[model samples]
Target: MLAAIRSIIFIPVFYGGSTPIIILAFLVALFSESGTHFMGRLWSRYHYLCARLILGIRVKIEGEIRNEPLLYVFKHESMFETIDLLRIFKKPVVIAKKELLVIPLWGWIAKRHGLLGIDRDGGGAAMRQIIKQARKAVAQGRPIIIFAEGSRAHHGQRPELQTGFAGIYKLMELPLVPVALDSGLVAPRDTFVQKSGVITYAVQDEIEPGLGRDDIRDRVHAAINALND
Candidate 1:
């Protein structure tokens, strides 16, 4: 009953105010990202707060966030992980699908804040773009985060990872930081009832980028599976 009411009020308020709120926030983040690279950090923190306050989601960190630029590979369970990581990490360069850039204020903000959007279906073109953007972000000293599975996992299943990450790994040559999360399907797909629970994030040791493509993928997958054990 409480969750339902929260959804009722939050849904209308979110839809009604999303455009203006995102626009204002985008502008603020633009200046912040440009001036100090702290806007994304600030926006993420407040964004998480709003998610919790408006929808009743809770998050808990279980390990220390690494302090260097590396490829952050994590389980893709839900949108919550995306937002939550942004809030926790400092200037994390995210790799997302290009379609997200088509959204109004949100897309603009993502592009301006240095988020890398890939054309997942672009074949070689997409790989090239990812490598380009990723190298630039790494050069700027920001960790590159990739949802190794490529897309969100279903209620009881995990998605197969695309080989694109392998290409990025080989090209850029950076260490890999394996991250895992316990629960993110609390709200489920296409639903608004945020089941209240604690989300756990575990950051593992960094894997050097010199491993073979298959080896790298296997190692990252092992880390994620280890979290489930």
Candidate 2:
């Protein structure tokens, strides 16, 4: 199929050609953080172009992406968003799995850039570390982003939020911004071939902080699936 062919060609160009850029990024991280920041932005933009041009995938963003130090929860269904980080926020402190912190030079760069790691299995220690990181991020005026579901779900699947999200929410007490999108239609999880489609990201209105646990959870759960269909 055309989709399969496109995927085959794109894999090498995007991934292969990106190697040098990432290495330069790593070298730049050795000296200047700003250089690394520029590299990160460049890498993300590269992926974006691949999705748009090679894969024929288009992203339609709805709603405003306000500038504020708030907790932003995005629906997780595919890894597409991982490469689209810069596109989502000007500067977002994304809370991702602690395991990712072990990825060689990349992890070092992420830690240096202040990304919070979540050790889902490390229990109390993990939570404590993430909370500390989150607090620091908020104080720095950087917005926090997390995939509330913890892991990618099947397309059209709506999963309950991981417990860690609620704890972080309550403790940080920042306003919540839930984002939903349908990137799976074009770039699905666990596969490389992509079908051309319009991926929509619907950002919902901000929810005030200090709501009851159940109330906030239910509200965000609904909002994060606004475009799941």
Leading candidate by TM-score: 2
- The C-alpha lDDT values of all candidates are 0.73, 0.84
TM-score for each model:
0.86, 0.95
Instruction: List the candidate 2 regions with Cα displacement exceeding 4 Å.
Output: none
Question: Candidate 1, 4: how far from true, in Å?
Answer: 2.7
Q: Clash pairs of candidate 1?
A: none
In terms of lDDT, model 1 sits at: 0.73
lDDT of 2 by residue, 84-121 (tens): 87656666788998888899877887766666788888
Candidate 2: residue 44 lDDT (0-100): 84
Give the range where candidate 1 is weakest over 10 consecutive residues by summed lDDT: 35-44
Q: After TM-score superposition, what is the CA distance of residue 101 in candidate 1 from its true location, in Å? A: 0.8
- Assess candidate 2 and give its TM-score to the true structure: 0.95
Candidate 1, 158-211: lDDT as tens digits: 555677878877887888878877665565556666666667777777788789
Q: List residue ranges in candidate 1 displaced over 4 A.
A: 13-18, 28-32, 35-39
